[model samples]
Target chain A: MADPAANGNTDSGGSRIGRVPAGYWLAGAFLLVVPSFASNFVMYQIFGWSFILGMISLSLMFLAGYGGMFSLAQMTVAGLAGYVVAICGTSAITDISQNWPWYINIPAALLIAAIFATIVGWLAVRTEGIYTIMITLAVASAFFYFTRQNYVLFNGFSGFNGIFPPQLFGVDWRNPIAFYYLALFWAVFWYLAVLYVSRSPMGLALQGIRDNPRRMAALGFDVTLHRVAAYTFAAFPAAIGGILLTWQSAQISPGTAGIGPVIDILVIAVIGGLRHPIGPFVGAFVYVILKSFSIDILVALGMAGERFQLLIGLGFLAIVFWSPDGLLGLWAKLRDLNRRDPLIGRLVRRL
Target chain B: MKTRTLLAVLAATFLTATAHAQTLKVGALATLEGTYTALGEDGMRGLRLALSQANNMAGGREIEIIVAGTDASPDSAVRAARKVVEQDGVELLIGPLSGSEGIALRDYSKTQPHVTFINGISGAQETTFVDPSENFFRFNMDGAQWSAGLGEYIYNVKGYETIATIAEDYSFTYTQVLGLALGYCAAGGEITERIWVPLGTKDFASIIAALPDDVDALYLGLGGGDAVNFLNQYQQAGGDAQLVGGTIMVDGTVLSSKGDAKNALIGVPSSGPQADTWDDPNWQAFVKAYQDEFPPDQRFPSPSLMATGYYNATTAAVSCLNEVGGDLSDGQAAFRSCLSNLVLDAPNGEIKLDGNRQAIGTNFISEVVELEDGTLATQLVKIVPNVNQTLGIDPETFAGFGVPGRDVPECKSSY
Candidate 1:
């Protein structure tokens, strides 16, 4: 078993490596450009949502792949951040909130989201595996109810709209394609940054703790501290996602923290294989694209749009039962097998 | 720099083309997904139904309504609107289902001065009575217009002394609930307590449990699914009270899904698409056309946000368009000058735009009752004409949240 405390990074005087898996990056680019070219409408709806969901799923990747923590509340944390944006940053004309200028309000929103996430992490990180899942789920459910009933703050059901994107480059960055690329750039940064961190000493220690908590403790790794730190680190990406969601929707409703959306992050992470960095994001892309189009398909088949949840749930179950390692893991296995089977390839070429 | 210059030139060209277009391009912006998906879909249907009917105008020039549906957020709405106006070059626009999205469009309407925004049933009172922009025209009832008749009846007709209101805590509900309070208090009824719940709240027991008998009636200010949920829970919990609302109650759309809410509440609503369509053969043909396109079950019992309010709003616009010979300036000026002077027939009434751009003429106060056939329905028990008077503030002084006063309206009378 790998030591949870051992960092993936070998300290070679902080040398930057230009090397990356070209095939994987190529595959990703292929996926990104296809939808943008196929239809402008799809670009806005599917592409935009995927990148935001990608950042959200990255939070789960941090916990599961790095810290060996399986968390369900990462999406809830992101949603809480979105609610914070709505409350603090929204202009009075859109939501009930007045323009609480960016300098003061943005920091306050992020700080509050971080503190909220930390408290959630403090509670959930105590348990392991399924128990942790349950606790995280309960926290998500609790937040959902709080936001739903507490009308004065969350605007109750019909959520506040009219959050204009910050005019950084003098453009309403709320435009879907622009927001999607921004989110993509951020997701890439988080991915690379997390990759580097995973190779660092802290990441190694966390991995050690994840593999054998008792052994890591004996080696002075502070197992609980490592778990909590992992959760906190995970929250930063989720919060970034939440902030982006505030941009995408231009308004945050109580539904932002609702049960379905929170659980959706878990499904994405697990379906893409919780074992890898790129897994959750890959799963999110599949989920968002399928979901955006499935409505029309369902309507054609004489099904209600509300049946969307039912379809997604069934798909998730199918993924879990049939392929525990998820689609990415399956692809990797197929590729490895093809590489080894030179005889089979030669036979096929001859035929 | 090149992108900026191109965009500027493109936008300018688009605006110029829009102003000079012979074929009318009407932008339909809405949500075809998520919680209020049905409402958004309905709004879109109204646009299709209206646009198709509108294209059969006197002149042979085709009026093509280009549509755009977003995920029903202010951000998405703005982006979608920009695409419609800038990319598509629509002369006029409609829809964006939610009050919040409509408000965003109202702001955007300022940038494109000549583009007339015929709203799609976003009934925030501020959209008209407060923030009335020259480019924007709200063709349906605001929160106050829909609730005014019922408010007057509950206060004066029924002599209900005290009332409690349960509504979704968004701006639509807030403005709606407040409209009820304003009307009720004006006619001598005191609102004892107000409970604002979220839109998709599955349960209402805790809220219902909190209610006391101090109030004679309860006002349910929710729509479609949430309304059904609230009423079902309220009734099952043994809370026996006369329920009323500024929302759909026993109407076709409400009753079809919520057969359980039968005889449980009095519903006060402005005219809906299917409600009055039973009397019109043309409307029957339209419903037949709709059923031919989509299955009867897939469509709501009545035109909801789309068929009901949005269709009516569009029909009003069509009427105005026809009256002014398809000229936007003439249409808007005619609407603004003497809306009630319009003799155009409609599913609702004469297509009249009041001073505040709200449809004036009649507000229906209906009672929820069970038919012998065991179907739930609202029978129009009352109709209050020119209900725009209930706004209290006169024809002028309609502005935004800031400036005059965005505070909750204060009632001087306790009794």
Candidate 2:
């Protein structure tokens, strides 16, 4: 039951109000120049997907790390936003899309996704541990089947294709550079927002509930309400990620919210490290790279290319075994070793 | 001066020929993992066989293949498609072996206007007929097109009055059910009930028990492992309804694995390109090539519909590439024009694209039978030729058919 407020420095001295970290500035500068060095495919397929998927996994990571809720329905929340975008936006398959303006569609998508997540969270928060996992999983499974069968609304199993990001302000947002920046902006915004919230009073209360719900309730905090509120807050990022995903692929289907993808978000979060806010993005980077190129590597190795999943599984297993806290935890351990050795510490500090 | 002019002309000709010989990258996308892996593998084999047969050259241009694997999901397929087009810079694309994936890839084709996308066994109707992409061409029949004469065959030939339909709940199965229901109801047959099991469902006990006892036949639209499970369970449940179905119900894997359940399809006519049934030279050559590539001990027992579909698609692509001298710089308009009016003697007969760039060709009414080697194979019972995407119905009426579901055709009376 770690106190959330103790995790980061507060603005007690007022030396730096909302100061941007040097590491963040460095990372931001690098990301801004990525399109110049990388190809359009790398921009869209790798970084773009990594950011979007990172955000989705971040939602799960937030719930698990801060609120002690392991939700399997984060992807479902994202998928709901995707479906709302498709239902509201124009597509090639069905005539159902009202062709609403982006301003209306974007907000409506987020609202619907948030509302859906809150309801699911309300139901899920009543349970604890594995029961919570099972309930979220059930909700995810139900949504998948519902979208698959309900043709009139969800367009049956095919769902909707040709769901492009609205071309606003005389620019196609789906263009590689624009899309990358859009995804990056949302991802970084949510990451900072999550960091800020985890230190906020409500975040402290939620963490208290996560650690000891009985004590929190006895102390006059509505534990369930806080947990549900955490879910509603988390849904914003997941929903935004979903909207981006729909834009990236220009489509939405049952497979978007399928069980495999639902599990994948958990895998991404765990592999990146659930403890830190940046862990999911790290995991997403590895995941997107592996998914895009592992097949080629397998084929080049003179093996069946389809066995890429085997490679991915092996990588995930090795990472989990190496550090349950994920890549970030592994990094922390190396950093500690560096600090213990003066020469190594100097080299790291110089870098 | 005359000799120098001759030398210059010859040099110019050689340079032009060399320039035209530039390598053309073709990307093959398929679900290499998950439930449809075998189908995807077969499609790859089929494409490879076609490419090898052409000496890996089309229209005097060297062809380099880049294979991309999807997990049979639309999201994976789109990502894979983006990789092939944007990263690999493949001029031509083939495959993505699922119904939803096909539609996704078709929509994706709109974004990649310069790249020509050919279908690789995905049979969703919307991939072509609903919102056809100028850049995407399907050289094989869609699910509905495959169901061309199954309803009429079952009603008039087999004398089935009322039928119950059990299909996977997806666009592909829906199109299949619509194809059969339209023909059967039109031929004075009634669809008593329609049961749509979700994709990946293994249990058919509840669905079987729900079937009407008076059903004269049961049309199955399940595929691969799901079909095997359902057939076995349907048999164990003591269900005696005469089982007929779409092409997937009688696939090679289903025929070989279903054991006694395969008897349900022994005399029933389904639709697809079965090698044993369609005895054309082109068809024979394809089967022979496939058998040569994959020996008896190899993974695939025989060329499945997926294999043949891709084989035919690649074959058409190569033929067109040859016709146009392998130059796709003009992009979609050039490829579309080359494909639209051209007809090739494909494995399934004459393969030609309609105005919508959908396949208009033969649909073989096939039945399961024990081959000389004791292996079960689908034998050609009848041939439905020149079957278009419309499935013998008027375009307007077919459009009005709506999405296929339970009680779609409005059964008049039970015989």
Best by DockQ: 2
Give candidate 2's TM-score.
0.91
Per-residue lDDT tens digits for candidate 2, residues B213-328, read: 88788888988878878878877888777778687778765776626777666766688745455667777777888888776755455788888888888888898899888767
In the range A1-351, model 2's lDDT, one tens digit per residue, is 222233776435544544444566556666787788677887777789999999999999899999999999999999999999999878765568888888999899999999999999999999999999999999999999899889788976668877888878888999999999999999999998998898899988988898899999999999889999999999999999999998898889888989999999999999987887888988898888778777878888998776788898998999999998888777767655755656554434333
Per-residue CA lDDT of candidate 1, range B270-372, in tens?
Answer: 3322243344565556556555655676675445535656676566666666666676554356543433445435555545666556665456666655556
Among the numbered candidates, top lDDT falls to 2
Per-prediction DockQ? 0.13, 0.29
Per-model C-alpha RMSD: 7.1, 8.3
Q: Per-residue lDDT for A70 in model 1?
A: 73
lDDT, residue A245, candidate 1: 80
| DockQ (model 1, Cα) | 0.13
| Fraction of native Cα-Cα interface contacts (under 8 Å, chains A and B) also present in model 1 | 0.16
